[model samples]
Target chain A: MMDYKYIEQLLERYWQCETTLEEEQILRSFFHQGDVPEHLRQYNDIFNYESEAKSEHLSEDFKQKMIDLVEEDTAVEAKTITLSQRFAPLMKAAAIVAMALTIGNVAERAMRENSASEVAGAPVIADTYTRTEDVKATIKVIDQNQSAIMAKADSVKTMDLIDEQPEIIE
Target chain B: MKEISFKNDILPLGDLLFRLALRIVGGNRPEAEDIVQDTLIRLWENKEQLADINNIQSYAMTICRNLALDHKEKFENQNISLCETDHDRADDHDSPDKALIKKQQYETAEQIINQLPEKQRTLVQLRDIEGKNYQEMADITGLTLADVKVTLFRARQTLKEKLSRLAQ
Candidate 1:
């Protein structure tokens, strides 16, 4: 016959909240051993129920389901970028380069036309001014020649009149 | 701080949390399962702060307890009594009458426990069923150590008195 006096004392302490966890565990072990006095049998159900309830567990299916749910959550949180999205910065750079080239071509053409018009009109204005100056110089030279000829002709007529007036005076 | 894997560290706590939830929700298994799922997901969502906690199991228990209580409040009227389906296992050595008597004793003890108030019931579950010390119980329950002892004493006394009556 085994002694249960210690178990009884432990049970008394257990109800008073004075038993250590180990001591309570000892009581549990004792009650689960299947041979108890008639007086101690009433307490068997409590310990047995406690021990059996620990067997109440969530199934493996529950575990796998939870893992799937969590993994799905992680998948949703981290979305994968497509190839196009990955090259978005490069695409933006290419578009900007294309736009800049188009603008440069248009601006260069506008500048070329402006300079070409200036070059085409510049010589015409210079030639017109040069021709006006030439005409003025030609007119001045003709005026000087006509004045010298008139002076010379007047001198010769005075000489002829001197010679005829001498003969009339005799 | 050690790195905590959700698979290794947190997932394994599902059974413990489920048991606690089952007790808090008054043996509503489906609701208990839901509460545990919510608790685990919540813990995983807050995994960043888990490394800072001293005891992750106690922290998880606290979260499970709070969520179970919230669920219990929402569906208070629909709670099934505890141990309603807890039939005793048959022993080959025992006679049929002995097995029936054992079953009745279990059912009676369960009914007596179920009649306890929610706080006392939870204390009993945490201490006797879970084998948590007073400090762990205090931590899980957010009660002071003295308060835990007092509450557990009252709960154990109630169980003892009711169990003695059943013996009579």
Candidate 2:
């Protein structure tokens, strides 16, 4: 006969997440035997399922198919290796864009600071009319650059659209 | 890394995954088997990650549950509705007498559980059917211990309420 106290303690520990594998096995065995007490009958289905669920087996054909899937994935990865191997040009292009942006930002800031300092140093020496004309020329240059950037952005969008509407469906 | 043999390390979990899939998918053997296969492939891909895992079974359950939910979502998306007839069809194979008895119990029980959202069903399966502890459930689900307890309490209450209806 099983010790009811010990079994009860193990059940408590089972709920509390402290039971070992052997203790869990004991619970399953106790529950599996023909005569579960009235109170524990409700748990019989659950415990039996817990025990039997572990032994649920897959078919042999399924196992072979899984191995085939693994092989297929590996083969696909191998085939894609050359594509990733050609990423150096893309990496270089990204680096070039980054460097140009950094340099342009620094140059623009330095030029602005230099002009501000010059204006401060020679407050009234330079002709105000000449400075106004120079600012107008700068505004025209900025307008031209803005239109160029917008045109470039529009072309990129059109290219994206073309790619999305693939002519040949795989 | 050396190739992990399916027969040695992972195929054993197929039966566990199958039953779990059966319970979740409700006798849709093909879909459940697909999910089991997917879970095994996922484990093989992430085998390195398993070295840190204490319980492979719990890890596999998490994968299986996620895959099963994904399949259900896809099924719903495809307009493949889960009709009451789907389960009724399963009952058709049983003898009329046994079917009557089972139908009575199944209706009362399944109605209550079927009313539960998918998350609650998954939790009940892990805790009640699979006998996973709170911590193991917490680890597998990434849910807190309190969350597992509250969900489990609600699940058991649902079962209890339905089971009591039989006495009536």
Candidate 3:
């Protein structure tokens, strides 16, 4: 008692392109059995054709050939990649060198400016907090200058006085 | 959408792709072979984006289909014979009577299918033969869901009517 009615309905659904993949596969499996009922025999070829077609494939060597071909492309691409790789290290070194030189020059200029300022402002920096010996040396130099000027004034005053006394005697 | 490596995942699809190319270009195995190889190479070229695709099988199938049709168009433009049915290839393993019947069926099925426009022909091959679902069909053929159904329905109807006519 084969289920002819179910097969018929499935066939109808199949022709309408409405069958699920499992249902369709079932149809194929059913047709694959050697003794498809008379009405289904004609449809057997159609279902079997799909399986036969699926078995068709390219040659075994094709994969290797394709790999070779794709690798050839990769070789060309790798060449360009290597070219970029080669320049990368050089560019990096140049950038590092430039950075080092800039930092070194800036540091040297700062050091030079500090030394120059130390030389230029050495007296001012010392005088702001002069030691007692430094003050005594400055006071001594000032007293010497004052004494010389006083001595010259005394000589001039004496000359004037002598002239006045002579007039009185006359 | 699992991870798809080009060598691990995509390169193995060559045979599947070859079948699709053979179907689209009407059984020119050599051209289909070249097209399949070219499609694989193209996949390799675009391997960077292979993982981004939701389905690598359908993606490769689609590329194989387009390249096959492109080659078919160029083949047609050259005014060469586009019909190259390889029925003899099926004869090697079948029993004599069975092989005869298969060859006849194959030739008839091919004749009926080749009469169709490329889309419907490919739709039939993808659906009935490949057993691909509607969405995969849509993805491979670049057709909308409704259009895939309509086209596949039409192809099925045409096959039914034609096969029945041959029976009668």
Candidate 4:
């Protein structure tokens, strides 16, 4: 049998929480050998519980259950993922097509509006000053600015034509 | 840092974490089993968070404890009685050492140990049973080192007094 004196002293220290981990291990190992005299037998259960409590585990099917549950969880999540993934490319392509059509329509309308504005402005300029005397009279009033007036009108019409094209496309 | 292999690193912690969940729920095996499953799944979902953790075992232990406690709280709210699952699980896998034990003593031993406060019981289980050091215990239980020592001290004291009384 082991020395009762040392074991008693160790048990006292253990209650006080003064024993180091090694001393506690020694106490556990000592009791584990089942060599205790009468006085120390009471402490056996406490030590034994420490070792035996570990065996209170889940069943063998636990790991497999977890694996199945995890797989199922991921399966549910994958559906939303595939839905989003499936839409992603189609949405992107649609956006690209929509954007291209918008630009093409705007450009086509702009070119048409630009040509129409030029045609209208050419006729208006021609209609504005038919005679040189009328031109001189308007020039005197407008300070020899017939050509300048036509130039300003042409530039303003061009800008207005460019601005209106996108509106017409929509 | 090396990559944490799920099979090698994470799965290996299951038994330890299971022991912890079992400890927290006072040996309720099924609930403990659920908590372990939830912890594993949660950890897997948030595996990205693992790379930042210094001690994976401690982190896993914390998750198990918290989830077990949450289950414990729900059970209390529902006023459900803790069943014989604790006894059944342990008895399901009786060891040779256990056979040497008197039936009443083995039964009373775990029940008495389980009766301690959650923190104290877990500390004792992790330290004495699992052979974890004080630092790891502190990390796993989210207690300061001094608090771990104090809780463990009280736990041991409680076990000694109760076991002596039971021995009669």
Candidate 5:
């Protein structure tokens, strides 16, 4: 008993592309309610299909996959680093430590020989004090050199860590 | 300017883009899925440039459409025709015969729309299904408003003629 004249008019305009978006929506809504009169039943499929098509969507798994892909791309490094390249700074630090130990041991031996000679030659107090000062100066210079080498090694290690943080986070 | 978060802003457009891609690539789900994935990845990679864009959804649609067209061209042999059955659930109150008829009608409707050319089908998907305005369709499709109307008119006309015959 409902008048479908308005719907028929909208359908005509819809085919002509004269209906506004809202009017088109009204037509869709009308067909979606079902129970179309015999004359309107044929148009039912078109609106129903459009309505059903709107439900077509990518799954949540697909969404998660896409997010993982984007994150992976951002996490990966463009320039690949080999194992040797990664540990090169560590190798340099180890070498510096070994050289410093050797130098320290040699300096200790030289100081031991000098003190032994001084003791045997009836060393004067002033001369003994000067020899002690020279040994102290040599040890201090060695310590400063060692500290500088360790500082440089530490900075290089820090930089390497910074560069590798992205991979680590991934 | 509002900041664009990939999860919130870009990723939500996935379903919309997927639907568009599906229509463009002739209902090949895998191909359509690939197109959407590529489109999202491209958008995320170039998200820095997206901050200035007025409508990111429309912009994403454009990118998605172009990628779909390229993918279709590259694999011309595999652009299988759309024959997917509608997944729409039958109304619980409907009788079995009515349900089957409704299902067939929906399938026929899909077949009719799928028969349209790529441009016309895409325009139909955007306007009728996606409920996009003419201006938005023009912006997404790179067509003038008048051209959008004309193309949509032609597409709808074809649908009308075919549907009328179907009713008869």
Candidate 6:
């Protein structure tokens, strides 16, 4: 004889939303039998519905397709790490250095320009024409030196860098 | 406190995930399976957290459901498999004649269920099919306890109405 008290307790927990997965499984199992009690017949349809719904299964071919997709994803993931693993540190360090150098150069130039402009204004405002000429001369020299470095670098053969890329057929 | 292995421990959750996904996507098996695959991979990646999780099935169900919803949103117009036929149970019933009649009733129920809005359908699936507790259903669907119960009540009410109509 089925335990009426246990079934009642399960029904209570079921309504209260306190049944565990195992307990829920037991309920389904009990309800699944061919011979359900007459008093509990009202719940048979609900339990049977649950049982029929739980029988939902993916087809074999669909399952295999999932496995294949998962395998492909893992393969792609492996390749991604393999490619990035070699260059990831270099990329990080290069990014850090590039950012640092760009910030430093911009700050340094801004400070120098600010100082020079201040110097130009201060001497002119102080009515010191001679000192203003000296400041102008110093700024000109710095500009000339910068241009000299640029001209030297410009004179280096562009073809030499292009050839280093190994795309030249000849 | 069980040690979880990825292939043995985690992969098995794929079936449960698929079931949840199928429910969410309204029986779109292909999309459901894809969601399960995605959920499994995520769980495998986050296996470290599984040990700390109070309910792995609920956690996995949430992942699977979310993934399936995202996919359904993305492919809103894509032709999906008519999933009601996937578990047709054509030859399993003891009496073919009764089974045929029951099949008609089952199809009618499926049609009514398929017509439900996504939230109601999923709520019904979680409540009536999966037999989830309110707390677990709330956890899986990311709904509050009251919201889960309310939605489930409305869903069951709708189904009961439809079933009654069918009876009539």
lDDT string for model 2 (B1-168, tens) is 455565677777888887676557654667788889889888987888877777888889889988987887787555342323223432566798866654454444444555567667667667655667778888878899988877766766665555445435
Off by over 4 Å in 6: A1-47, A60-170, B1-3, B80-84, B88-90
Error of 5 at A140 (Å): 49
Q: List per-candidate RMSD values in Å.
A: 11.1, 28.7, 10.9, 16.5, 24.0, 23.9
The residue-by-residue lDDT of candidate 1 on B1-168, one tens digit each, is 777677998999999999888877777778888999999999999988999998999999999999988998898987755554646454446798987877776666666776788778888888888889889999999999999889888989988887788789
Q: For candidate 6, what TM-score does chain B get against the true chain B?
A: 0.88
Work out the TM-score per prediction.
Answer: 0.71, 0.51, 0.68, 0.67, 0.74, 0.57
lDDT, candidate 2, A102-170, per-residue tens: 999999999988987777547644677678988898777777766665676688866554334322222
Q: Which residue pairs clash in candidate 4?
A: none
Best by TM-score: 5
Candidate 1 — which pairs collide? Answer: none
Write candidate 5's Cα lDDT for A1-170 as tens digits: 98989999999999999999899888888889877899888788899888878888888999999888878887883878899999999999999999999999999999988987778455576688999998898777777766665776687866554333222121
User: Ten residues in a row with the worst lDDT in model 1 chain A?
Assistant: A161-170
Candidate 5 residue spans exceeding 4 A from truth: A79-170, B1-4, B85-96
Q: DockQ for all models, in order?
A: 0.60, 0.16, 0.54, 0.48, 0.62, 0.16
Q: What digit string (tens of lDDT, one per residue) describes model 3 on residues B1-168?
A: 455455687777987898788878777778888898889888877877887887888998998899988888888665344556466777897799988987887666666776777898898888777888998999888899999999888888887887777777
lDDT tens per residue, model 4, A12-65:
998887888899889888887777788788888788667666765556688777
Please, what are the lDDT tens digits per residue for candidate 6 over residues A1-170? 76688987886676555566678677878877747777665555555657776766756776566567666766777543576888999999999999999999999999988987887668666778777887888777777766655665589845554333222222
Ranking by lDDT: 5, 1, 3, 4, 6, 2
> What TM-score does candidate 4 get on C-alpha atoms?
0.67
Error of 1 at A146 (Å): 28
Compose the digit string of candidate 4's lDDT tens values, residues B39-109.
Answer: 98888887778989888888998888988889889886653444454344344446756644444566777
Candidate 3: segments with Cα more than 4 A from true spot: A81-170, B1-6, B77-94
Chain A TM-scores of each predicted structure, in the order given, are 0.50, 0.38, 0.46, 0.46, 0.51, 0.35
Best by lDDT: 5
* Candidate 4 residue spans exceeding 4 A from truth: A75-170, B1-5, B77-83, B86-101
lDDT of 3 by residue, A55-136 (tens): 7777778877777776777677744367778899999999999999999999999988998697757876677667867678
Per-residue lDDT of A143 in model 3: 73
